[model samples]
Target: MFVLIWATFLLCVCAETGLSQKPRVKIPTLTEGQQATLTCVAPGLCSGSAPEITWTWRGAGGTESYITGSSTSFRTKTLTAFTQRHISTLTFNSSAEHHNTNVTCKIRFTGEKITEGGSTLKVNYVKEVNITGGTNVKEGETLNLTCSVESFPPSLIMWSKLGSDITLHNDTGSATLSIINATTGHSGQYVCTAKHMNNTLQENINITVIYIRTPQIIGNTIIKEGDVLNLTCSVESFPPSLIMWSKLGSDIILHNDTGSATLYIINGTTGHSGQYVCTAKHMNNTLQENINITVMYIRTPQITGNTIIKEGDVLNLTCSVESFPPAVIMWRDLSSKTNSKDTGAYTDLQNDSGSATLVIQNVTAEDSGQYTCTATHPDTTVTSSVSVIVSWFSKIQDVSECVLQAEVLTCVCISEGFPLPTIKWPLLGNHKEYAIKTTVSNHTVNSTVSLKVKNHGNSTVECVSNNEKGEAKKNLMIRSVSDTVADSSVLNVGYLEIIIAFLIGVVLSAVVCCLIKKCSRKKTKNSGNLDETLEMVTSQDDPQVFMFIWLFFFFLHNYKVFNCAQISSLLKYTYLVFWFSI
Candidate 1:
């Protein structure tokens, strides 16, 4: 009983002492490079309890430790959670990264419970780090780096770039260091440090940022129509770049020599003259560049000339022009002389550069005029001229023998001369009835004249041919028809004989008819009067005797009929006869 009472008295004293002193919780022991936590617990403290807790540092190098919340001189920094919490906690991952660190916990109790503790960390695991991905990155690209190490219960991970701290995404076993939308400024070596349970590991990755995808010039930038043209297409890439030539906006191959991003053009033409671009591909990135090409060709040709020409002279014409495939030569005469009205002769020659020539044969005075030579090619036409001169006109020769009336007349003269000749009658004044006629041949252009005159005494007539140079005349004779009729006569002696015969016949017939009629009448009357008829006969006896005498004379001379000139002689003869007969 005496020993129990003595223990009770000792316990009471100890309790009082505990209440007077600040309570401190024991900080756990931690290994180097390992994650750990130091807790300061005041046992039996309620939510209303207020305590002042402080953390102190004790270095592993045997230096003096740092303290806070006490009047003691120390090199220590008080953490934020320790200033107000009655139970203080230092939550951290223990690693080799902190192998030389020392930690201490102190508390000032506002209530009855208080605790104080201190600890030192010692790292143990072998430190290692691994950078799983490449260190190099492109500008404006995603940057991801994984840092991992063999650790227990995971590790505390950190990322840094060029000496700057960077946020890290950490999982249970690995940590990833990343930069979203990184640029050229973000290019450098990156370090990933991981702290595991009492172990520390680090990984350093070298990054060489490069511009692998670059602009390129693809295919031939300059091309021609007929021949090959060289084009240069250059690009920058990690490997060789892919360059191609295409028409505007199309994917079809524009050139054949597709090289490994270099200058190449197999066969080029105007069709290949368009936009060409190059595609530079590296990894998953691509770039492009463009170029343009144009084609050229030759133009057409031209010609010129004159229009007037002469007969006996040289004719010269020309045709000249320009073209792509070299111009062709042609000479055509668009005139009646050449016979070709439209298209002309084509003269093909090796020397087709400038102009072609056309010549005419020996010319005449009739040919003295303009001659046109037309030169025509594929797309154009031109004209030229030739001049000629001649000496004189053509020739003509011939005449016909002609007959004219019995009058002054002229013969036609047909002949040829240089400038043509005129004709006239030379004997015009000698015969008034003579006239002349002149005619010209339509086809021969020769002049001929015929002359005529009166048939008086002229024996011949003359025709003259004259011109500016000289004159020649020819003669023709004429006969007269009126001179033969001037000395002709006729006589009439048969008319007297026919008249005497007719008068005798008429007188005999009349006497016979009268005697017959008178005898018939007397016979009828004397039948009754014979005596009266005897007396009438005796009285007529004297008339009968006279008739007898006249009859005898008419018979002796035979009855004659005479004209008026014989009538007087006949009467005188009648009276002499009467006397003679008596």
Candidate 2:
């Protein structure tokens, strides 16, 4: 009997504990501030009378409490079947504090028997979205971004760039976004999203890259004189790098700006040529580029040697100019009709520093004129000139002839020379009055000298013509005063003979008149009365014959003093008196 009773007790325990399914509790995870429902199902719980069912709660800290009717709701349902099933539900508003909390359902029978079923409350909620990472990163480096959600239900987190629909990272409660070899293109606003149940939260952060690349310099390296020089410096960076331009060896900064800078040099010269550098500064690092600039220039030529050279002497000249890219030197004679280089009389020697020497052998008067030295460069030509002069002389001419008229004596002399010769009469005496006349035509001089010969008759006169080169002279003799006196005596004797002949003729005419008058009176006395004829002959002959003879002698002696017309008039008067007496 004892063995049968023990077996019966074991079968009853197996039927109550193992043979039936345990009461089930089902609860859903919910976001904060949302309504939640807990369901409890007990099958085969109907006995002879109705059983009591109650609900209770347990906190995550192991505390327990019976649920009241004010903030909680309980509902029960029975199914009509041979084996009855009973269902109970507990409802409440969920919160972060309700996470991991437990809700229990209990049933008590009439004999003081009890059964219970419980479920843990999982509240899917997040209090805030938290992000922790660096926003600034260098180029070509690694970028790390992490996002965490501080919530009870372990919210889903996702990382995405702003204005993009694709997700970069996705995980539960936390997520990390990593980028390898980050560049400037990776810089922008990023969005981190936390999602739980029906709630979604987002946070934004900006990312930037700070890095500098090699700087670029833009301009022509080779430049001409007087041209404007322009150059630009450029760089690529995230933080907007500082750009600066400067010479390679100098500390002076040419330009400075933000991202790009420009350097301008107006009217550049040879002094502006050098090495230039462009530097970019970013994030405590610097990058640079070097450029070489060359300037081409030239200056006016200068002549430094003697210009005046003597005949049959050597001529030397030096020409120089200051220039870059050394100039070509040449010597030219502007007065020469032909090219100077082709003439063998000139020699040219040139150097690399734009200097040259010109040599001429045995210079003559034909080489006198303007000579030029020319320095030529690729951009310009310069020249300088010098004038040369030569001095010389010519020969003098000889004296020609001498002439004499009355008391005046004249002599002529001539000379031919360059720069004109001077002619003079050197032997003119103080007592003798003289005049000298000189003239020049076609570089030839002619001189005439006249002197009054008074008592000094046999004097010698000299004509001298001279110049800086040489001198010449001639002498002439004058006739004596005795020879001139002898000629005058012959002329006086001829005049005396003419006067004696005239006087004799006058005396004979008077004698003829007296005879004719005496004969006429004798004839008249024979023909008529002698007293009337004698009276007529007396009135005609006596005083008229004597007056006519006296007048003829006066005119004949003074014939040399009076003219031919006066002598002829006196002779006619004497003839008229003689005819009247007859």
Candidate 3:
């Protein structure tokens, strides 16, 4: 009974001692490459002896071993007379390999009492940020990317595209960025940012989205005729799209290029006005766009009328033109040389759809001028003219007479008409040797004929004037040479006197022309003879000679303007009178 009580008392005391002396471990926050200290404290209930403390480690692979490369210190102290404590501190460099590892603190007392405490090790550590995914993706396909880093206590990661303010994804573990139906607009550089403890890290990746845009046509749909038709077709795409321009109904391609194409229709006409299509082909897709073009134009005016109308007849003319827009028509007399529409007092003007008509009642000689019809449209103006001629005949003047001078018969006849009447002498048709001349002014015409006659003629002495409208005739009365001597048609000089004056004038004219030719040749030091008769000098070396030549040509060119049929006749009328007066 005494041994049993002694054993029971010892067991109770040991239980209390064991409960009070359990080893305690204190672990603070740890980081890689930082000096770390782990402390194990024991109760100080036992006052007789100190406790032996040691450290041990268990790795992530479940391997266990005694801790190495660490310094440990043991210290004992008494808080009071009845209380005592022991402390064992272990110091080592913190590393990433220590993360999630198990460390234990063991204490062995003098009475063979063993006690231990432990905690799982934790270290704050993070590596460089990383992004994983393919950077090149097709349009309308999914874009999958992951941003992550190896870290203790898992770092916060975020995914963002460069130049964007919004974060695409964020996570405490791997950050995943998922985009459905990606487009070319989504192409750019992406960044992955990792924040771990006191460190922030970033990594970059480039992505490209390939796609094709809708084809578009650029140009004016409405153009004027004869203007160049310019148009362009283009598309936005990767793997450059092929662009082609073609007319709507034709299979021929007008232009072909990559990404863009230009079509040209030079001097485009009404035939070129139609619909055009722009086609774009990329990868496996085909796109098209169409545009309608119209070419506006107008044609020249056409005039129809009777240009030659008889006197007292009605004149009618019509002007018409073909154009897209109806035209404004006007009838005008071009004689005024003005743009304002002006018609004669006796004229009627009427305008209809695309045409104008002009009518004149009782057309007369004054109406024998150019009459024009003008057609004007907003785009252009066209004009057409017609020459109108009024025909009429008047009788020959009764003053017509025949004179016999030195056995030569001379006759004079005059006629007046519109479309100037033509005079014919049946008497001259029988005589081959005759000099004839005709003069016309306004609506009057004068014809004269001279022939030698020794005796009475077998044919009648008649003058006839006629035209497409009517005819006029007169029989000239023959008179003795002495009786018609005062007639103004011939000079009233004696035959011998007339002959002498003509010879003298011819000699004088010849001498003057020869002297001028000789003088011009001498001035130029030319050896040519005076063979160049009365012709003007063409040499530009002498101003005086040029002036003289100019005047001579002027006179020679103007002499025919008057009724001076022959040089002899002029001298005969004037020189004779001068000689007799002198």
Per-candidate TM equals 0.30, 0.51, 0.44
Candidate lDDT (C-alpha), each: 0.50, 0.69, 0.77
**Tens-digit lDDT track for model 2 on 154-187?**
7889999999999999999899999999988899
Model 1: per-residue lDDT, tens digit, 95-125? 6545546666665545445556555555454
lDDT of 2 at 243: 89
lDDT of 3 by residue, 389-450 (tens): 88887668887777776777888888888767889988877676666667788898888877
Question: Which 10-residue span in candidate 1 carries the lowest summed lDDT?
Answer: 485-494
Which segments of candidate 3 are over 4 A away from where they belong?
Answer: 1-155, 163-168, 174-186, 194-231, 264-275, 282-306, 312-363, 369-415, 422-439, 446-465, 472-582
For model 2, where is the 10-residue window of minimal lDDT? 485-494
Between candidates 2 and 3, the lDDT winner:
3
Clashes of 2: 0
Better of 2 and 3 by TM-score: 2
